[model samples]
Target: MTPFIELFTPVSIRGMTVKNRVVMPSMLTHMASVNGEVTDRLAAYYAERAKGGAGLIFPEATAVDDSGLSYFRGLSIAHDRYVPGLKKLARAIHEHGSRAGIQLGHGGRYAQPEFSRSARRLVSYLPGISPEEDARVMDKEEIERLAGCFVQAAERAAQAGFDMVEIHGAHGYLIGSFLSPFTNRRTDEWGGSFENRMRFAEVVIRGIRRRLGPDFPLSFRLSSDEFLPGGITVDLAAKIAAYVVHCGVDLVHVSAGMIDTNRFTGPPPVLPMGWNADNAAVIRKALEGTNALVTVAGRIHDGDTAERILREGKADLVSIGRALIADPWLPHKLETGQLKKITPCLSCNEGCVGSIGKNRPLSCAVNPRVGFEQRPARHVENARKVVIVGAGVAGMEAALTAARLGHAITLLEKDSRLGGLVNIAALPPHKDIFLRLIDHMSHELVENGVKLVLGNAVSAADLKAMAPDVIIVATGSRPVIPGFLKNSSAMTAADVLSGCPTGQKTLVLGGGLVGAETAEFLAAQGKEVAVLEMRDEIAPDMQGRARAFLMEELSARHVKLMTGLEVRSVDGNGVVIVKDRYGNEYPLPRYDTLVAAMGYRSEQSLCAELTREGMRFVAIGDCVKADKIMAAVHQGYHAAKAI
Candidate 1:
């Protein structure tokens, strides 16, 4: 019905056809065995998505040779043992009318020590790249062997019933090293000139085609630009695109670099989101007369944008990495005219990219069901009567997840509308992304039939009146103020955040994450602000990169912070404080708002009451113990699974 629905329609590539336009591109699911065998968990995970109705599934990068894999868990086609499980996965995908494709790769220089890191010893010398080049480089014989390995992988893909094959030539991997001026320094036939630079890459493409023939649907993922000055520019990328298209490739998958230089280019505030489409489009134009599909994305959230890009000829296909993690059903929901109901990707890069660097599995900050969808929330399976007190993030997620599983639910909120703290929390500077979660989760609960009870906490009497089979106490938390600190005009950070009414030239109490961020928010509002904290450091709890950015931003905004200070009392004009760190006492002029951003105390009393009622109870959100959204969302999901 919507334009987005058209994007979800079936499309054919070469000899194979997919059920929809949506493609879950190659992200390392990390579900492979250490020895490279795919497991049941991996197969079932892909099957669940197939059953959920994805058009095509390109399961992670499949290393073509043993030395090519950089990660211990990366899937590989280097051995025949990888075939049977690949067949099983292919079958599962086909059962849902979807096609499966394997992206074969080789990590030349960036080999992980965890997987074949020692194998780099056998590689040869580098010739032209930067000083950071790994001493180990592939020799001519190794290049030839890897080419054959790629062909073998192609043959195996076909034997295992894969619909197509994509060559992993981007992301600063081995293929990328051979392509980038900054990484590949070979002087032989495989390096030096632009033609030499593309030699090894073209060899892989030509080799796979020699094995699978013309109609096998071979796709090549190419980094459009190295993002560095001496790096492969869009100009060089066009030539590279032309070369691959001429080598019998059926698709050109455009992407950018892996690390430094080409990291975040294209768009502003580009950790991820709508930055790479223009580059993908450039690649698409390069192959205008050729018969090849072009796909591009660094960050794109929700279905409308995906469809609009396709309709506008921005890219033949749009690949979503971050958004899908937020909500796997994004495409299906879009196809069914449910765009507004979709939970948008925040593009925070918190768990997805950040955690990946830390060597943990990729995850989404907002969507807890990402990597562990095997045991997703079971709504009210038996249609039990459930009454949930306090509608916050955790309670909302609980109610929504439970109701979807077919439960009769009543969500009680003391506030007139949902989004307990989110309504105010999002108002802080740069908290727009955090705010989106509230709107999304609230919409999902209300639309999916969670009954709303407004204007009161569920009193003990009210709980008895409901006589529910299940009761969830999620009354949330309140700010903590230390006894020694005294500002008569002071209010909790919630009051300032609520924008109820605060004076100017105020001293914010507490120099933690909330205090720092609130100070940043206030400074942006052109208010003179100063912060007083008892600790030595400020915003110690924030993520490293984000914290750095916040500090730089606060500094630029002229926000003042006084650490190692203890407040004794507050008068109408100012607050009395002692700085033991500096051994001095002074009354900083406040005149306006005083805030307590120290911390929150759990409302476990309500949870204890429900526990004594002999009802199946779960306490979530701030009430269960205040922490980050990660703990809150996961607790809500797993807790519902208990029922």
Candidate 2:
């Protein structure tokens, strides 16, 4: 029997039958051509997940009209010229034994001005926020035209052999904006009353149904709660779900939060698993008598949780988004009882969501081969003896990759434990999910027969004696201790996170990710903490949902955050002196502990030593340059492949 029996069970939505309950919801990949044409890379990306055994796959959101293009490389169904490429994409999924679905959307007030024909396809007037808000309200005729765009897009999807098409009505897009009371501030027939506010979505749904006929499956994505004062709440969302089902929607994809409340979208681990299950239950109940199926997705990472969601009748299906990016073979693993082999999604958002937000190709921290699915890792004809120093993400990944390619791999770490910096990183509040990644890698290394030599520092003599064909230096990095704190009794952020004792009132002297996280960790332990940074904003390096959630956590804990203040020196009484940007010095409040989290410096001594010995070695991760985990993992993967 399958491990996650309910999750692996086949399910049908409308007339379309899926192999299993696992559905891959649409996520932006930015792999399309600049002209909105599907590229081979995009096709390969979707094909991979489909091949990995996802029952149903939705490849990102596609634009219905040129005026609604949000991403620079987003797919478009506005013209017939795009049909050939789309047909190829659908065929790729079909060949992989998965049903293909495409999500149709119009960005409206959220469309980027640079990529769109017009930046103002809003439902109503929303003041200056971005170029998306500078718009004229759509007239009755304009509304009809927008509905026609949806109809045509659905027609094109059917023509391209797609199994189904999902209407992207969530996340503050064109249709969602109209359905939301927070943005649909209108008195016309298209807004105001409940029925009026839902008119636009109804129009799009009915138009697509009419064009595609009743047989073609249609799914409507909705935000069960926009998380605003007067926005779409659970009550309103249930009603809306029922209404859409009545209008011929075959499935209701339940999601929560909008662009404004984006911290809930692709949420970090700070949030509970299956965070949107309750909202989905409400919507599912609302559509109880209807034929429409319901799917819930929001941080639903594991197969066990997905099975429970199905067993409890919260949703007819489960949509795995970011987790699939981390490991596309999750469904296959569950079915084959290879639970331990499945790589866990850290939900760090530093890779997939964060990278996509910055208009870059989507990548995953745990899995580096995200966009380059076309190029699979192949075993080399000649297997070399590979020695890796450092058992962090970088070295571990390198050893795993090389061992998989039939190389004799030995991973050495100075510390007794695996996951060098990752051990300390996972110590922060709500960040324990990171440990799952290291745990998975460690298991893989052992399973693949890679020799693990922990608590052993490899010296020059040791390397020469081993006489390895290739060496990967992944020494990682060390925390930067401020000049003033060098001689003082201040602790490093790593030291504190690694279980070093902290005082009653601790002062953290950096407002970056490390500092802010350290402050939260301390405050959670009932210790009073304050953070000071030279920059105006805290956690500048961090962005999107992670930073938003961190800020909220910091505020709730009453952690004092001071910015734009540089450390000057330590006074005679041991009180730390800080100076504002204006050069005015001030003595800080008394604190028992001061942690220096200024940043990190690369530990490149091993690389220098190798060069001095006239030995060649590939240095990856922080040993080359101190950066985020994504960079280190990616470098390790590619460096091993190169060897």
Candidate 3:
């Protein structure tokens, strides 16, 4: 039996019906036509999503007029001249069994200064609202032109074979100005009273209905709650929804907090998850029993959670933006009950969030083939005897990726088990999220048919004897020490994390993430702990939010951290240290347990020997350089592709 997914069911609004509940909503792709027509690249990009199994493809907000363009060259639907290209786009989506829709947007006063019609844009024509503050103001005559532009755009959508059309009313856009009281404070008919403020959106909806008639479905996306102090509330959004549904909208798509309000509209919950679904429930509860369907989005990962939401009737459909981007084949994989085979969304935000903001292509950190569907899948040049010498994150990723390319792979490990060192790195009190990647990649190696020789011993001679076409040496690295063996009593960060053996009063030696985190873990276990680093600050390389949170936790837990302290020597007594940032030798804290996380050194003996032999080989992951898992996984992916 197929596992249930609320996100997998079909949705029909008006005459338009989609195959699945998954809707790839409009996202601003900086790709556009030079003269505001749909370019082939833009067409191919959306087609990739359609082929990946999206039931509906809403192309990025296309400007209805030249003045409405937000980017250098955005897709436009204002002119009849653009219909041929739009028709081709609709045809491409229909070929994949997905209904195509285009969003009709007018930048209005929200148009950027670089793209503004003049230095001033209309914020609102009403008193107390200035056009320059938000956008160029629309005069009475200008409003008629803009309304006509939308009507003509709807006619164009019908001609282009688009099944439905959505008016861009959310995210502080053109119609948004008329909906938001903060932006629209006019006493006129188009502003002031809630009913009056909604007039512009109502007019735009009426214009779309007039152009497409009642049979064609039309949906309106709402901000739900603006998230700002003075913005609209849930009760108000529901009232607006009821009013609009009566005005002829077919669906109510609920999304919370956009660029202007929350400023963090990532497709998924970036780290701490489940914020979006709560907001979705609120919007859905308000619109319960209306003929109009309710849809919600934001970080809806894992098929089970999505299915439960649908089964419980919390939402009619769940918009999975990042999950779909990560694996376009997610729906097909779920239907076939190949759950384990599905590449889980790591929620790293490396590909989806970073790519969208940087104006680069979309992709996923766990899945390397993301966003490059246009490029042919990377395959092995020929079946070659390949020997992998480590089984950590880097080693495993490289082996599995290469194995999938049809290479004969033999993974060798010296230790009795796999996960060299990383098993220790995974023990942090707050590193649960990072640790999950280790599990994911390890599973991938076995499922992809890579041969695991865990206990086997392999030297350089054994590698040559195997006559491998290529050798990827991932022997990893050794912890950095001021003096090796002499400081044997001082455990490395790796050993301390594993908790194999340690004393009660522990002094961690490094203020970076590893040392700080180890101190946290040990302290939480009721072991008195202090951290000493030669640098003035800790977690300097950490991201802003995580660094702030870790710092707060360290302070609250009373984990003593001493920076700019230089260590002397270690003996049975403990670590002898000094305050040497300015060369002063003041005595630092001494302890019963001294943990050294000064860092790691490359295990280059095997890598060096293999490189010197003039052999066809690749040295990747920590074996090349010791760093975070992101680097390790990234290098492993590229290295395997290169082979």
Candidate 4:
């Protein structure tokens, strides 16, 4: 047997044989055409992942009905018109020797109201819909119609040449809502007792099986634990799994949480790796002696962890979601004993999930070529000598890209290390996973033969001496201290994070991602920390789930949060803040330390000098604009390609 026996081993279910145990579970990319049709861009995205050697490629959650749509450009199988595009997608996967599966889902109550076209609006959508209104509750007719939609979608998937179909009965979608009493509060046969609540799922599964026959493979994705009050527990999910298997589901893909509860939807770095493995194990044991295969998803990034889960009988298959996004060739690398070459997912959620939330095409922070699959960089005939200032995320990415394109590259950093702000950002609690990116990029730089110059600042005269063909400025940014507080004896958040001395009590001046994280870092160090924000909420820039996790951590540490407070001025005693509730100005209690976490400003001095000299140069990352890791990495990759 191979070293990663459990992970590399093939598994068969209901006449379908997967090449391995590595499954690429459904993840929405929002790259479909305007009419919810699969475009070439979407097909290329899945084809790339399938080429990476995953056993089963389950494309993103596709809506079975128009009312179930969640994203603006989400894929759909609502009608026969979508069959051709889906066929192209299925062929794209099959050509790469991987089995393709489509996840049929209905957003249910959590579905976007703007996208729903059903005559009966979900009760959660409007204020006027009362319990007595037949439109509010899914009547028997609507339930039958919904089940028929699932069956028809499954048939279309089979027609599209898909090897299997997955019923998305998780994440508080329509089927999941019916399974949980928390969302299904109806007095009909679909609600009340456990058997009644599961009736909808059983009906849908049996209907699909009746239409598609038992020869075709069918998988059911379930939330093994909703992780909310009045939600389905592991025991209930086990029973549901047993019932679904009896109803003809060949596989059970175990996941956790619902959309209403953000934390469990996508567990961030703060949560432990393989956070849902225990729940999956419970369901797997419940289905023991059955023919159903169990697959688990939730931070199962690497081959080691995936193999462990299978070897321990926790799950039969491991789903790699964001990890495959960060490195599409992850499975191929793992199989070929090139595990060190794999770029791990940071779980930052700054790009993948965050992009979807903002109604944009999904992209990866580490891998910028995600959405732009058709536009790969072509090797230049005449390779130019490129000089990149600042060995930060952007600078390193630019250097690596240029070097890969046969260009001579030099990466310069004034500091002794690489990873400019990332080094400081990773110092916070539960954020050490971010350092993996720096390590991966650093290794790439050396492998790609990019000249690395550390602890050396480059000047305009030095650039002239070097005579580089093109220069990329990624000088990064500096923390901003409001002018009103500059004169006060307050240190920037960077100083505090970089091991500067701090008093027992510290007040963080901003409540964005940086400020909130800085406050948590200080609180973890036994400091009495308080965060003041001008906005109505804290960590407004962070993803919903990650922000919730951070907020909970801060609360557990007793860190104070003061939102909608404008800082007036800072003095030797303390800072003066104005409450936005009634425009009341007051002085905060005396505090020994005042930390300025009020975000950053671009450092464009080098870029300005180069522009003034009429040098062929491009500015990327913070020097261009102070944004998150996504913008910086994307800018770097494109700038390098342009050069």
Candidate 5:
């Protein structure tokens, strides 16, 4: 028997027989063309995941109508002109031996006005629009047209050789808006009563069924619990699920949360794994004896957890969303009994969600080849001898990549440990998952025969003696102390995370990701923590959902936050601060400890030394730029590949 018996078991939906129970649920990747056409990049992205051996590969939510676009580069199926490009995508996935599926959705009131030309015109005619205002509501005629649009999109999917089409009624999309009372305030037939609210979904499913017939599989993605006040409840969602199943829906994909509220949609590291399993179980039980297959997606990253969820009858199938982004070969690795080789998703949202929020192409922190699926590592005709300084994420990645390509490699770390700042990052609450990167890379270095040296700092003289063909410096970065706090007894954020003792009252300088997280860490340890930010907002670099959750946690823990405050000078007892908004100076509450979280400066001394010695070396990661893990790992991967 397979180790993940339940997860590896094949399941049939309608006439389609999926190879396994693993479902790659829909996640928006802004890889399509600006005009909403399915580009080659998008096709390659899905094809790679399909090649990774997932049973079902559902592409990101494709807009069913022009006004339904949520992002600038969202894929669309509103016209027949898009059919050819979508056919290419479907064929690519099918060629990789995975069942191809597409999610059809309408953003409705949550749609981005800038993405739709019509939306911009409508906005111009309306009163002053606040950023927080809801999107323009569609009238009865528009709602009917959207239902027809879904049917046409499903028909197009059938033409594209897709095995299934999922109606995206989750994540506060168009159909979801009609289902939730929080978004639908209309007194018309589309709102008010529960049955009336679900009328839009019922119409969509019936229209698609009528167009595609009974043989084609149709899946419905629903938010079993909106997780917001006056939003759709679990019981209400179960009722809707029963109604949809009765209306000829073949599968139910359960999820939770609204995009506007940011209450759910993607669980960050702060939330426990399988946070929405109970919601799926409720709907699954509600739809018992029905023909629909129930699937749940919410932080079901690992095979063990996915298997447990299936074995315990939580749902019929499990959806691995972001986990697939981190390592597309997760399913194949699990089936081949190489579970340790699978890269883990840290749920940091730094690359995937964060990039999407920034309107950039989606990538992964652990996996560098996420967006560039068409390009694989080229084989070297003659491998070179390589030496890497530092065993951090970047150094480990460089060594592993170079050694995998038949190069002789040696990795050096000044510390006794393998992970650099990752060790400090893992010390935070619910962030231990980051240590897996170090563990995986260290194992790969040994498996690939890369020599690793620890607790020994290598200098330019040492490199000259070795005479390496190629060198990579990933010495990482050091914490920066603002000049104003130079002589004061201020400690770096690393010190706080490394178990430095804190007093009853602690003042944290800097309100970026590091500082905010450090403050939370101290507050968790029962310290009275106060965060001081020179900027107007705290954690400006953090993703929207993550920042919201972190602020709420800080508030719950009674951590004081003082933003727009510039430090005048540091004293022995407390620091004097000036409000940047006004010119008012004030003395804050007495704080015994002052921790500096004012970001980092690149450790470029070694790089400068290598340059002076005229060594053939390249600097990657923090040694070149003090950025996030995404930049470091990406640079390391590419640098080694280039060599």
Candidate 6:
């Protein structure tokens, strides 16, 4: 018996029946060739999700016209030459009993000029903060031409054997630019009045309908709320949703925010789960009389929430993005009543969204085998004894990987608990999502038959006693304290998170991710906190969406953030004096405790001690280098596999 019956039930749009309500919505991977051709890596990525039990899979937004290309490696459907690659992608998804779909998009004024090499087309002349902001205002002829491009793209999608094609009218793209009053200021037929503003989308939709006939499934992705002043509100978006359904759209996929407010588009952990469900419900209500099904996407990561949305008629389907990236097998696991086995997406945004923004291929912090789906790990036929020290993410992941390959594994941790640094990382506000990763990985380790020994520190003698064939050390890291404050009463951020006592007023040094988060934690505890950094910005190493929300939270809590300043000296009484970049000395506000969150140093002591006894072991995670979780996890999995 499958769980979450509503999610696994079949649903039909136009004549296409999707096996379930779990939709893998379009998300950029940047896995295509530089010239916009589909690559084997991209196909394999989509195929994995389909095999994982998704009802329908929509590939990332494909450009309808070359002049509207947004990403350098974005997929394209502008010309017939691209049909073969798109066909292969569709076949890959179809082979796994999943319906394949593609989103057709044109970036409009948001298209990167470097790659497009053409003036961006806009509904009206938007005022520029600089001269380069001037874009080409589309004339009536140009509008018709672009509408034809959309129709051609839909035709190509049908020819490539895709089950459906979703028109990308959300996220401040070409169609969204014309629909939103905030960007469309023209008095022409394409803008001004609500009906006029929606003309472009209607034209494109009607054109596709005429070309593909009434039997083909068509989905319109609508931005239910622009979240901007003078933008399309819920009421307005509902009317537009009705209009689009009337204009021949079989489904309305509701999303939120525009390009300027993209943080809400791919929301990080700071945002609420299923944040856009309410707006999607509004659209569903508006389409009450139409044969249009609604799908909602935005930070939704769980079966309970997806089930509730469908049960309450908030939406007919849930389009999950980042969650599927973290674990493609999520839907399959949920269906088989293995919810606990599903690897939860941390909503960290450091991997999928952050990596693509940096022009790198998509990846997940919790799941290392994201982009490299084509290369599957091989199981070893001859099992060997493997001993792993530390039960942190790296160590646990290595243990599970090796154990699954038929290796006899034993995992040891000095601390009573698992998770290592992640246990402390989850202490900050809205960061409890990370605890899910810890829970999932730990459970998986046990299920894979990896022997777990906690509250015992591994020594060289222990390795010799066990006589393991392979040894892995993932002892993690320790906080770095400045030399001048090493002997003082200064405590590390880890100390505070570990329930160490602090005074009413606290000063946190090092305004990086750890320091800012520590400041937030202290403020929440009713402590008047301040963070001082020698750099110009706080949390510079953090991802964009998470950093933005952290700054907002700090300001709201009245936590002082002093940048371009360093600790000059501290008197015997612990009264600290600070200096700015200009060498101006000043006394800080009264504070009883000072916490050092400067950074962390790799815990390499164990590796060296083991070497002295002629024990060869591979070090992973912070024990190798004090970096992000991705590096640690990747190193651990690959290192264990090689052995």
As for TM-score, the candidate ahead, 2 or 6, is 2
Clashing residue pair totals per candidate (backbone < 3 A): 8, 0, 11, 0, 0, 0
Question: Which stretches of candidate 1 lie above 4 Å from their native place?
Answer: 120-135, 260-273, 350-367, 371-383, 428-436, 483-485, 488-599, 608-617
Residue 246 lDDT, candidate 2, scale 0-100: 92
Error of 6 at 228 (Å): 2.0
RMSD of each: 4.3, 1.4, 5.1, 2.4, 2.5, 1.6
Cα-based lDDT for every prediction: 0.74, 0.89, 0.73, 0.86, 0.86, 0.89
lDDT (Cα, tens digit) per residue for candidate 4, span 414-511 = 99999999998888788888788898888889999999999998888789889988888999999887887867888888888888999999988899
| Ten contiguous residues minimizing lDDT sum, candidate 3 | 262-271
CA-RMSD of model 4? 2.4
- List candidate 3 segments past 4 Å from native: 5-7, 28-45, 65-82, 106-152, 172-193, 232-236, 260-264, 267-274, 378-381, 414-440, 455-458, 475-603, 625-631
What value of lDDT does candidate 5 attain over all alpha carbons? 0.86
TM-score of each: 0.84, 0.98, 0.80, 0.95, 0.95, 0.97
User: Weakest 10 consecutive residues, lDDT, candidate 6?
Assistant: 126-135
lDDT of 6: 0.89
* Candidate 5 backbone overlaps, count: 0
Spell out the clash pairs found in candidate 2: none
Q: Mind giving the per-residue lDDT tens digits that candidate 3 earns over 1-643?
A: 6666456667777756788887777876555665677766677777777877778878878888767766555678877899999998898788888889888887766565555344333646545444435355667787778778888898999999998888887777777777887677667777778888888788888988887777989888877777677777677777878788878987777766545543335522223443456666666676666667877766576677678767877677777666676667776777677666666665546655555555565545666665455565566567777788888777887888888888888888877767777677657764555555566666777877888887776767778888877788888888888773364687788777765677778888888877887888888788888888888898775543345556767888888878877876554566474657777775555677778877778888887776677666788778788876656766777787777
Report the alpha-carbon TM-score of model 4 versus the true structure. Answer: 0.95
**Residue 156 shift from truth in candidate 4, angstroms:** 1.6
Pairs with steric clashes in candidate 4: none
| Highest TM-score model number | 2
> How do the residues 1-643 of candidate 2 rate in per-residue lDDT, one tens digit apiece?
7868888888888878898999899989999999899999999999999988999999889999988898969889999999999999999999989999999999888887689857577787766643534455678898889889999999999999999999998999999988888889889899999899889889888888888887899999999899988888999999989999999999899888998898887888888889899899999999887888999999899988899999998998999999999999998898998888999998888888878888898889889999999988888899999999999999999999889888999999999989989888899988898888888999999999999998888777789789999999999999988677767888899999989998899999889999999999999999999999999999999856889889988999999999999888975555889999988999998889889898899998888888899888999999888888888898989888988
Say which prediction, candidate 4 or candidate 6, comes out ahead on TM-score: 6
**Model 5 misplacement above 4 A:** 120-136, 483-487, 573-581
